[model samples]
Target: MTPVPPSRADRSSPGEVLRAGPLEIHATARQAFVNGARITLGSRAFDLLLMLAEAAGRVVSHDEIQARVWPNRHVSETNLRVQVSTLRRALGEARHVVSTVPDRGYAFTPFGQHAPEPDDAPVPGDHVVHVVDDEADMRDALEGLLMASGWRVRTYGSVGAFQEALTAQTAGCLILDVSLPGENGLELQRRLLALGLSLPIVFLSGRSNIPIAVEAMKAGAIEFLTKPAAGEDILAAVARAMALALSERPQSPA
Candidate 1:
């Protein structure tokens, strides 16, 4: 494991401001400016910039970046890369200030600059969505829909497969079908609760099973939809689930 750096609050005063060429970062206010004009940056992008800027000339490893920007979430390298690209775009001409160190991580070179872009910045997705359904067609369809709507999606054909892939740090929403060959969706939900994993879930059933739906909702499922659910409805449910997941993330220390 890469050694974790000191918290940002530990190294800087509340109102401290950092400068990199023409860019200015207001730490307390969590805002950035370029040439005296404010720029639009997403929360994650801003966090990434702050971490890199504070570290300045040091190479902040991928692990450190993920720990600071995502806190407890288990995010892929692609997520970090995307945020870096976002930060670079926000920085405009000064984008070269943020450089990727080969096989290591990223660094904020205040003096030097480079022009290597991140490889094929994956679809502009914010979070991963894990889909578990026994039907191959359903899994593929959901994956396509979610990916098209800017979500990183992974599909599994069985509960076992999903469980095998899951870890304590897995951070995302789950779209699970209620029926399976064994260890059904409801059982998996119960097991997850017992294991203390609070991953927000959206339940899908081929038939409208009111009792199962009630059970799932009672157990804290974000949404329970019966197929053939409309595409819009599924997307809406996923959005809600993603929101819930975001809300449940542990906040970083101030």
Candidate 2:
């Protein structure tokens, strides 16, 4: 198997092996092997795969993909298509997980009848990310990555605690788990919305149900991620969430 060098995303991860059905991805190492044999991926292909993997199931648009893969220069649509084809070859039969949405973008599954469209609304102030996940490991992992990346962060093991904290400090973004002991992330999101709290929400889940993801998107969640997602993907989502929060932030009196 080929030894894949670490990427920026790997530094924040625990170096554990991530399993998605038959594929094995080493997050810390930035390597993928199938049946113990290494799969070769060009730099662009790897970046694309990592982005999709971290999305947790959200459809990543062509523009977003280009921005990630080619941050500076303009990449032609043909180039994007070529890179996608290459990634599909690497995934082999498992590639079906990456589904194309004509006129929209690419999603991780075929179950979604439509695609998520991000708003450019702006909010202001520090973009603190408030994370709520029952798993201590998950919470720590996110905190380490987000804080190290220069984002302000606060974490809670439950929605109630996060809610309590919100009264004092409004988080610019919220990263939450779909499953919790009581009052899951979706419920908390609804509650927040009712109270006029529209912070960008990003959902993480080990149990991925398409309908539920759709529901979260419908409720205005920035993104819904499935478990074992790459830290890079989480970071990308957080960036998006923060941008939304900044746009949505109320205007201060001039």
Candidate 3:
């Protein structure tokens, strides 16, 4: 039998708090705790947990899970499975709380349900990694790779597309292709500087042009790499960019 998707009331609002076994979930704050100790969860994992826990004891179908978690984005089964694995790992010994419901989907079985102790951990900011490449295949590949690594990702086909979607409040690093159809990566970098946007950029070029690479570095690019860069190298560059971006981000007032 097909499971019914949770309605608005059935879904947990960001302001609501949920407790199941040793898990204490703060939907509003986007946080979770086990046995009063806060646990680190990727953004997607946290969202999945809230959805399942809100619909506790009920099966959330694969379609519903993908829609709720990825929203308008189309993701592969592997993405969902990877996120589930990540969430389960974060749950530790209480991983059984999230159970696979045969071929239907998954359910949160409120095992050993109990009240949660008070917790006061500050919430961490959520960041996304943006990838801009003219090649559709490249964009998809990079998105999957980064998402699998637990980083939220957004991809664009060109500088115009990226600029259209960018805003002052946008956070995270950018993986940019050097030779774009319009504006090009270096031009965009210059424009961003003129506009005072401090988004960290990691440039990828099909050709190894020393002059262009040096210019990008002088303009404050976190890393510049020739195309077909190793996955480990890309990941490392992104990690450094994220660290720089987060450090520059203004902290919220207490």
Candidate 4:
């Protein structure tokens, strides 16, 4: 039998499988696996990861991200960061594999990992609460309290569903979960801004971490209530959100 030439066996292609820490990336296949389990990564993110991994260890500048990710079209750095955030969340335990250099571009550095957990509690009674939480028990608990207080409520488990609701009827306010399965709260907030939906947002978090709360407020949330907050506190937040929403609504021709 004839042996294959060294050139044929030594070449690497973009289709070759690449590894960054625990992640197994197949650029050609347009997919990735973590610890042997398939994980979801958006198309833009998939391309972003390929570019970063191809860098080996050198930082890829913001200009490079734009050229590669949005070539021939302009995109804001925020848009780029949103994709990075999604990529980081998808990376989960190995999120540190990607690094963000201060005042510089991101780089491919497979040197870290991360973890996750969940919690519970209740708050808020309102007009169309529009809860976007995947956790049913928590959603039900909030529903019970809000209904008991004579407040209307609507619940959704995904951003797509909530967006559908937004199209159907404007809500008084949105009670958003920071840890939604996809897009999450912050990402949703940005999307809402892009869509010109200024509906007041009230954030709910079980952890109630200060930094998280600060971020929520910074994103224009009417209030940031930790889980297990008093029924009255929830109602108070609802009132604030509703009032703000009402004020923002356009007046009918008189």
Candidate 5:
């Protein structure tokens, strides 16, 4: 298998191997092990485990896991639950390393930290993602990818729809088409800023010249990705944007 490049989304070198307690984590090769026994992990499962290990003793919110593991993909929690269950079973009682925080999210305790005192906090809503694209295929593909990686995705086929969605719900990040049906993406971004919403925006299109990319960046796009970008790259940008949004939010974990 090809090694996934290192990104903040993935917490390892391109082909580095990791040994933590009885478990071994080889992020480059996408493999895991416990006590010299090989543990089978799918790409998604490996990504989740890597996120937990990176946190390594802190409780990783559901949104954080979704952003890091799935990136620009959108998926329902059912899939996430199945994968987590499988991982927990594979790890068995060794899963003390991966602790569920009631309605909040999962935490990685590593092998050393003692169990944390219970904290009663409200379980936040599912992570929110916004996709603005006039092309149905592209929108659906991106939404499907995000869902598979684990997030709640909303799609807008027009600027009006995008604006309505923005006002109706909260979004961790925005995936915007550079050319919209009514107004250009740069214009839309200006409007977003005018409204005082600093949501992270990512631009995508089939026409991403250096000039256009530079203009979009100046208009506040965190990244300008071409249409049909690699899944990993798209995810990396999305994860970075989400982390930024999460940091900006004032919600304190109870």
Candidate 6:
């Protein structure tokens, strides 16, 4: 990867600010302030906005956006456009900083004045990580690992527990064990997809082999890890999955 050049929004520099309610976003952190409350952005959106802000006052091509946002597998340009559109709507009509670059790509052009506070609390959109494993020890371990890595972790021992939790809170990524007491992990994944609940999925299978992993991946698993996997590998895969999930999450109106 090439080194990122210094920008006006750098830690030491001052750039145009974006204010949503009480949220004041500096170049760093991409923090959102609402009614004196701080809102956290998911990792992927934070990185994406930072890259766009750093390229403020200039046009960033679609290829550049894809290279920065998704460094993994190839993604379509439409995906990048959708994300940009979502970001714009989230920013509301206060000022349209993100502008289209016609056929080439997009550019940042700040407009409009900051508005007064709205009456309602801003709906939170932080990335959440969910773990589902039958073993108590493994469930606790994964939760601890994900929390230490700065993710909001939720754990479940069975599919019933997971389903109940999903009713309360949505997750950005799912770490699922293939074999569960009630519904198998793969079966659960299939169900989630059928119900239109699509999040990045990582499968952990004691029986994970070429065929099993391939089947899981074909069934929409992002990555499959066999039992006795190293912690770092799991963390990396989770991070990647979280990033993908963040960009894919359905956005509410601004």
Q: Candidate 4 at 42: error in angstroms?
A: 44
TM-score for all models, in order of appearance: 0.51, 0.54, 0.52, 0.48, 0.51, 0.51
lDDT of 6 by residue, 190-253 (tens): 8898878867888888863666665667776766777776676577567657756655666769
Q: Write the per-residue lDDT of candidate 1 for residues 204-244, one digit (tens) a residue.
A: 88887756776787788766777886676577567767766
Poorest 10 consecutive residues of model 4 by lDDT?
Answer: 1-10
Per-residue CA lDDT of model 4 for 10-79, tens digit only, reads 1254666777666788767787888978888878888898888777767688999889977889866645
Give the least accurate 10-residue stretch of model 6, judged by summed lDDT: 114-123
Model 3, runs deviating above 4 Å: 1-126
Error of 4 at 46 (Å): 50
Give each prediction's root-mean-square deviation over alpha carbons: 15.1, 13.3, 18.5, 16.0, 13.8, 14.2
Lowest-sum lDDT 10-residue window in model 2: 1-10
Compute the lDDT of residue 230 as modeled in candidate 4: 59
Please provide, for model 2 over 10-74, each residue's C-alpha lDDT reduced to its tens digit, 9 standing for 90 to 100.
Answer: 33546866555556667667887666677888777777877776675677888999899789888
RMSD to the native, candidate 1? Answer: 15.1
Better of 3 and 6 by lDDT: 3
Q: Which portions of model 4 miss their true places by more than 4 Å?
A: 1-127
| lDDT, residue 48, candidate 4 | 91
lDDT of 5 by residue, 1-254 (tens): 12221222344356766555677777677887788777877788888888877665566777787788888887555445445645765764355566555345666665655434254232236446788899999999999998898767889898888776566236478888888877878889888888888778878878647677666666656667777776755765676566556656676599
User: 81, model 5: CA deviation in Å?
Assistant: 35
Angstrom error of the Cα, residue 219, model 6: value is 1.7
Name the candidate, 2 or 3, with the larger TM-score value: 2
Ranking by TM-score: 2, 3, 6, 1, 5, 4
TM-score, candidate number 4: 0.48
91 in model 5: Cα distance from truth in Å?
A: 36
